[model samples]
Target chain A: MREMIKMVVVLTVLSSFSGGLLAAIRNNTKERIEYQQLKFVKGPAIRSILEGCSNDPIVDRFKIKDGDVEHSFFVGVFDGKPSTVALESFGKGFGGNIGVMVGVNVKEDTIVGVGVTTHSETPGVGSRAKTEPDFTAQFQGLPLKKEFKVKADGGQVDALSGATVTSRGVSAALTDAAGIYERVKPQLMEKLKTFAN
Target chain B: MAKTLTQEFVKGLWDEIPPFRLVLGLCPTLAVTKTVENGIGMGLATTFVLVFSNILVSALRKIIPSKVRIACFIIVIATFVTVVELLMQAFTYPLFLKLGIFIPLIVVNCIVLGRAEAFASKNSVLASTADGLGIGVGFTLALGALGGVREILGNGTFLGKTVFGPAFQPFTFMVEAPGAFVCLGLMLCLMNLVGKK
Candidate 1:
């Protein structure tokens, strides 16, 4: 019993120290990490989808609260108007969660572009969702009211060859984005007003 | 003591080199070697974890009870891996994205835990640090070679740069899963052949 207590105490102390050390490192690098993620992982897709924006989307980003969740909106001033915004929505993917960035031209009630922000899909197979522009290009100009689904499921978009599951994941993410946009349209519009000034 | 310390370092470079002589840490070895860039990133991230964990484990070896030492070692290792993950996300976001999933997966990597148990827990801190460095360099070299071969044959490029002429037909198979296994197998056979002498 005494030995058991000693073992537990030692383990606890060690774990606490480890936890504290990690927390320190995390806090120290938090800002730089957010910047890196924005610049590299999410930046390219956001830029490609929201091209021709006068302001940097990453810098002009804001978050809105809808109940417990906070949704990030990247404001794009295109043609000298902050009428476009991109937001992330997630859905089940072949390997894990797939994050899709849906760019909305709020005034037009249509998607400006769609890009895969993050995904764990198989490389060269399901990962075509990220690398292959042709797959994502189909999302452009899609009306907010349109139901997004792969052609195999009787929808318009053609799925990537040999990556049907990933295709479905992308479609599902876009569908989810449509719903999110509908729910947050009023707040999103209000936020866009701030970026314009 | 001095000779043994030197031995610990030298052994990891060849006699016990990972994914080749030891046949350990095969997950990242196979996954990240798709590109030399990814291989080097994964290798360095892993080395950072290995070195720090080994040092911490060795420093605390005398105080830790044998009964729950594994738990303690895991805690130490996990903290280091998280630190690596966070730092990489901050400083090297592109590489971080390229080696996605594999970064966090380093927590469960056998090499880190294996070193803590088989070496750091018993050895002096200096010796353990040397061991970590040697093993890390070896892992990096092996991964780099594998990635170089795959990239060259599969894409007719070296580190994403065009090496072969436009007319050169890529082998294609070299970048695929089967090719990773075959290449590693052939490399191991060659190492064995050389070792026999």
Candidate 2:
């Protein structure tokens, strides 16, 4: 009985000590990990979409709550004015969800550029949506409020050859981005004011 | 029967190296040794966990009851692994992404638990620390050498720089799964040949 008590007491003490140590380390690293994720996972897409911008979009960011989900907006400064914002949205692809980063000029309500952030589509086929620039380039300068769809389903966007599903996925993600932009435009404008030089 | 501190430390470098000599912790050794950078990163992460866990286990050896000692060792090792994961994510996000699930899998690495059960549990804190560090460095060097061979032959590059002229075609087979097994076999054979003396 004494052995059992000692075992129980020792295990309990060890577990609690571990828990406390982990909690402390986690608290310290949470923000830095978030930033690192942004800088690596989503940074390339954001950078490409906001190309030629004066400010580092990854660093100049804000989040707004839409219903229960919080959406992050990366501010892009172009020609000394912080007028563009890049946001990420996802759509169902052939293999999995495809993440698309969309940059829009807040003042003009037009797309500055678009880039694919993440996807699990088939290589050499569906993957072209990310690798082939010609496909995503079509979205540049388009009005942000317009519906996005592949040309196959009677829309303005052209689908990648042999990759209709992935192209449609990208269009769907852009459409989702439009709705998200409309919902958060007011909050975005308010936040961008702080970055004005 | 009692080994000196220097012997405890030095033995891990060659006589008791984790992967090559002991033939333990093969998962990360096989999976992440595709690049020199990845191999080294993984080795360092494991080293950190091993050393810290060794110290903690040795320190608590007196208090932990034998019946629940395994549970206590796991808790201690797991806490340090979590700490390493968080630190890697916070600072080395790219490497973290590359290492991915393998980092978490380190908890099950027999070398860690084996040391805690076999050596740290019996030895003083200082001796355990030396053993861990020696084993960790040995693991790192072994992984780095393996990665160098694979990367150079498979990609025709060393640390991403072209080792051969542009005219050289990469031996792509050296980068695949079967190649890993073959390379490891040859390495084990070579180690045995050299150690025969």
Candidate 3:
């Protein structure tokens, strides 16, 4: 009985100590980890989409609350005008959710660029959605208000040859991006105004 | 028989090296040793966990009851692993992405639990620390060497730099899964041959 009590007490104390330590470390690292994730995972897509823009999109960012979800928008400055905003959205892909970053020209409502940020698509096949510039290049200059779909679905976009599912995934993500852009445009414009210098 | 502090420390470098001599913790040794940078990063992360967990286990050796000692060790080790994971994510996000899942898997690493159960539990705090550091360094060196061999042969690069001229074709097989097994086998064989003296 004494051994059992001791064991229980020891395990309880150890677990509590561990929990407290982890909580403290997590609290300290939360913001930094979030920033690091942005810089590495999403930074490349944002940079590519906002190519030739004067400012760093990763640093100059803002968030807007749309219903229950909070969406982050990265602002891009061209010729000193903060006219482009990059937003991320997800779509079910060949393997899992594909994260797509869509850069839009606020005044024109046209896409400046579209890049894949994350996906679990198969290499050399579905993964080409992220790798081949030709595929993503097709989305450039297209209006953001329309629904995007691959050629197979009777849409304007041409799908990659052997990666129809991945191409469809990217198209779906862009369509989702279009909805998110329309929903958050007012708040996004308001946030971008602050970056205009 | 009692080992002196120097012996305890030095033995881990060669006589009881985790992957090569002790023949333990082969999971990360094979999985993340595709690049020198990744190998070093993983080794350092494991080292941090091993050292801290050893210290904590040694400190709490008396308080932890034998019946629940394994549970206590796990909690302690897991806390440190979480700490390492958080730190890696916060600072080394790229490496964190590369070493994804494997970092969390450190909790189950035999070298860590084996030390906690065999050495740290019986030794003084200072001695356990030395053992951890020694073993950690040994693991790091072994991994670095393995990664160097694979990266140079497989990718024709060393630490991302081209080791051979542009004309040279890389032996891509060295970086794949079957290649890992073959490389590890050859390395183990070489270690045995050298140690035979």
Candidate 4:
């Protein structure tokens, strides 16, 4: 009992110390992290995908309402032109959940960028969607209007070397995003004016 | 005091190496090590957490109760993980995205918990700190070697730079899961062959 009491006291002290250090680091770095998130993932995405892009507000699922559910999105704009738009595609990959954000230029129906925000592919196999030719290269110049798919399914894109399931998952997500873009393409273009403001 | 601290520090590298010697952190060791860049990134993140947690636990060794020690260790480890996650996001955004859940998963890395319970709990602060550094370095070496072999064969690249001639046909299997085991097994054989046990 005496030893147990001593052990409890030790653990409490450790917890407090670790908690204090953690709070200190988080407080110090929070601003830098916010700045980076704005500068890199969201900002570069806009410049690459949108024309005459300057600044854009990234809207998560909160503001945008869906039919019965709200979805997440971000847009880039300059003057009045909707230069860039990003749509999230949540889909199942070979191993599990996959989330990809595809940035598109509605004017030319071309993809300005692709980023895998989340993935649970089978490590080296399916996860290569972020790096390899068969996945990302396919997005570089394809029309947002074209049916997104793997070459195996008679589309113009090649699937990953051994990750057909994941390849298919990402393809489907892109397809869904493309279709959604087609529907809201005009509204998104008009709404680009509000991105920076 | 110095001799006692020496034992605490030396054990992490020699007697209980996290990956190759102890076989504790096999997940990321097997998963992200296709390139030296990813492997080094993961190892360093692990080290950062290990060092911080080990020190915190050692500093508070006098008060933690045995029954709840494991739970407390995990919370402390998790907090350090959050710290590493934040720092990586700030300085290495690309690498941070690449690491994904494994960053949070460091809380489960046997090395952290093992050290907290095994060494830090009984050891002095200085000794635990040494252990943290030694184990961290050894783990980094193990991961670096694994990445070296994988990238050389599978991608024909070294540390994200090409190290092979154009004529070389990169072997695909060398970058996959099975290849991780093969490389790791051979590495263990080598580590054992030369290690001063």
Candidate 5:
């Protein structure tokens, strides 16, 4: 009887209080979290890519068309131009998952910007390289026709002094983003045309 | 058993060390300990959760039922993790972002869960609280050791500043995943050697 009573007490304390608190907060804040994610993480990328146009939320899996990637992103339209797109790329790095926010200008066939959405790089080397302007600046203003390579390989970009592997991983992610944007560029342009009308 | 609460708290310093001796929570210990600051942050957050949850769980262990006890425990842990996440976001947003999923992932950190199962679930509330404090501090210290070595060697710095002179080039490997294993492995071996004494 004592054991049974103890178990009853344990379960009630665990469930009734903590569980109730989390459930209440989750229910109360669900909409706010959803709104913030939309406004902060995605919103800036959308505006940057399309330059002041709004977009339909991109889904990984849809009722009609499934979004293929795990992280969801949207495409934006502006004045009959599909100027920008936001997508996440996961690359295996020296450590683990390196998720990056890649924004591209489809019209120019160039990258708009790349930001570290999430990464597990080594603190002083690989992680630092991610934000180093010299490393990141290499992506900016280069059109689709330009070769993406470290100057060591006869390309324009200079690799970080010691973080080549991480830089390569990030650059590979950039290349992948460019490739993906190429595929959907046409549909994105069409969506913008409709919006302009 | 006759020791005061201060002794109970201080015992986590050597005996019952969470990471080295108990070997309880190795995931985040391995995953994020590339720097001492990162480890410290993770450790403190985890300790807060462990102390609070242990106290609450012991207090309520008499009232809970048997069949759904595991689910109930998870709910309690998850709530505290969420609370820490919110508090970090409001105050330490940068560090909050740096911690990333590891914050929520603390819900599964075996140290907190293990104590809940081994001590808090069975012992008096005061004893459980003491145990929680001991284990939590021990884990923090372990993380700090790992983080310290990696930060110093990999970047020639400690806690975001250059501690070593400019001439000391960093060993890149020390900050990588392999470094986490090698450093911890070496530390473990050193610890075992000391234990034999």
Candidate 6:
């Protein structure tokens, strides 16, 4: 009994110490880490998607409550109007979740652009989703109401050669983004007012 | 004591070098060595976890019960790994994204746990730190060399820059999975030959 109690006590102390140390480090670096992620991980895709916008999408960002989760939306001003908004959505992919950033012109109900932010698809084949401009370019100026599906599934989007799964994954991600944009349109529009002035 | 510390440090470079002499921690070795940048990034992260875990384990060696030592070591090692993960995600977001899953996977890296058990548990703090430093540097060098070779042949590039002329045809196989195995096997064979001599 003594030995067992001693073992339990030792383990508890060790775990507590480790947990405390980790908590301190995490708290110290939270904001910087978040900024870094914005600058690097999601920055390029956001920039490419909202390319023509005069405002910096990363800096001109706001968050909205979405069913207990707060999701960020980047506002982009184009032609002197804060008319476009971009946000991320994820879909199941070959290896894992594929993250796609979709920019929407809420006023026109058309997409500004689409770019892949993160994916674990197979390199060279499935990875073409990120590298192939033609794939992502097709999403630009697309009607948000249009159902996104690969050509194989009787939709307009073409699948990457030899990477049908990844193509489908990307299409699904865009569909998800469209769904999100539709649901958040009212809230997003209200938030856009804050950036306008 | 000084001689023993030096021995522990020096041994990790050659006598007990990992993924070569010791034949440990092969997962990250295989996964991240496609680019020199990724290899060095992973090695340094592992080194951070390894060194800190070693020092903490050594400090608490006497206090931790024999029955629960493994659990205690894991908790310590996991804390450091999370710290690295958060720091990397904040500062090096692109590399953090590129080395995804592998960073969290470092918690289970046998090398950290193995060192905790074999050296830190039985050695002094200074010696364990030395051991961790030497092993970490050795691992970094090995990954850098492997990544360099694969990148040069597979893409005709060094760290994404074209090293070979535009006319140069890359050996695509070297960047693929089979290529990773073949390259590692050949390198291991060469190491064995040198050891024999």
- DockQ, every prediction: 0.70, 0.93, 0.91, 0.42, 0.20, 0.67
- The TM-score measured for candidate 4 stands at 0.65
lDDT for B16 in candidate 1 is 90
The lDDT values for all models are 0.89, 0.91, 0.92, 0.77, 0.71, 0.88
Of the pair 1 and 4, which is ahead by DockQ?
Answer: 1
Model 4: per-residue Cα lDDT at residue A108: 79
lDDT of 6 by residue, A1-197 (tens): 99899999998888888789888988999888877878787999999888888988888888987787778888889888998888888878898999888888889989888888999999998999999989888888889874689999999888889999888998998887777777878888888888875
> What residue runs in model 6 are displaced by over 4 Å at the alpha carbon?
A31-42, A66-70, A79-81, A88-102, A106-111, A114-190, B1-4, B195-197
Best to worst by TM-score, what's the order?
Answer: 2, 3, 6, 1, 4, 5
Residue-level lDDT of model 4, residues A1-197, one tens digit each, is 78876767766766787789878998999878876775565554334444355554443211344456555566655465545567776667887767777877667778877766667777788879865644575687677774677888887667887888888888888887787777766666555555434
lDDT string for model 2 (B24-113, tens) is: 999988899898888899999999999999999999899988888898999999999999999999999889999999999999999999
Complex DockQ, candidate 3:
0.91
Q: Could you list the chain B TM-scores for each candidate?
A: 0.96, 0.97, 0.98, 0.93, 0.93, 0.96
Which portion of correct inter-chain contacts appears in model 6? 0.95
**Per-residue C-alpha lDDT of model 5 across residues B107-172, encoded as one tens digit per residue:** 999888888877787777898788788878888888998899999999888999999887998999
**How high is the TM-score of chain A in each model?**
0.84, 0.97, 0.93, 0.65, 0.63, 0.86
**True-structure lDDT of candidate 1:** 0.89
After aligning candidate 3 to the native by TM-score, how far in Å is the CA of B181 from where it should be? 2.8
Where does candidate 3 stray beyond 4 Å?
Answer: none
**What DockQ score does model 2 reach against the true complex?**
0.93
Task: Pull out the clashing pairs in model 3.
Answer: none
Name the lDDT value of residue B51 in candidate 4. Answer: 90
The order of the candidates by DockQ, greatest first, is 2, 3, 1, 6, 4, 5
Clashes per candidate (backbone, < 3 Å): 0, 0, 0, 14, 15, 1
| Tens-place lDDT digits, model 6, residues B1-197 | 44677788888888888988888999999988898898889999999999999999999999998988898998998899999998898788889989999999999999889999998999888888999998988888888888998999998988889998889999999988888889989999999999896
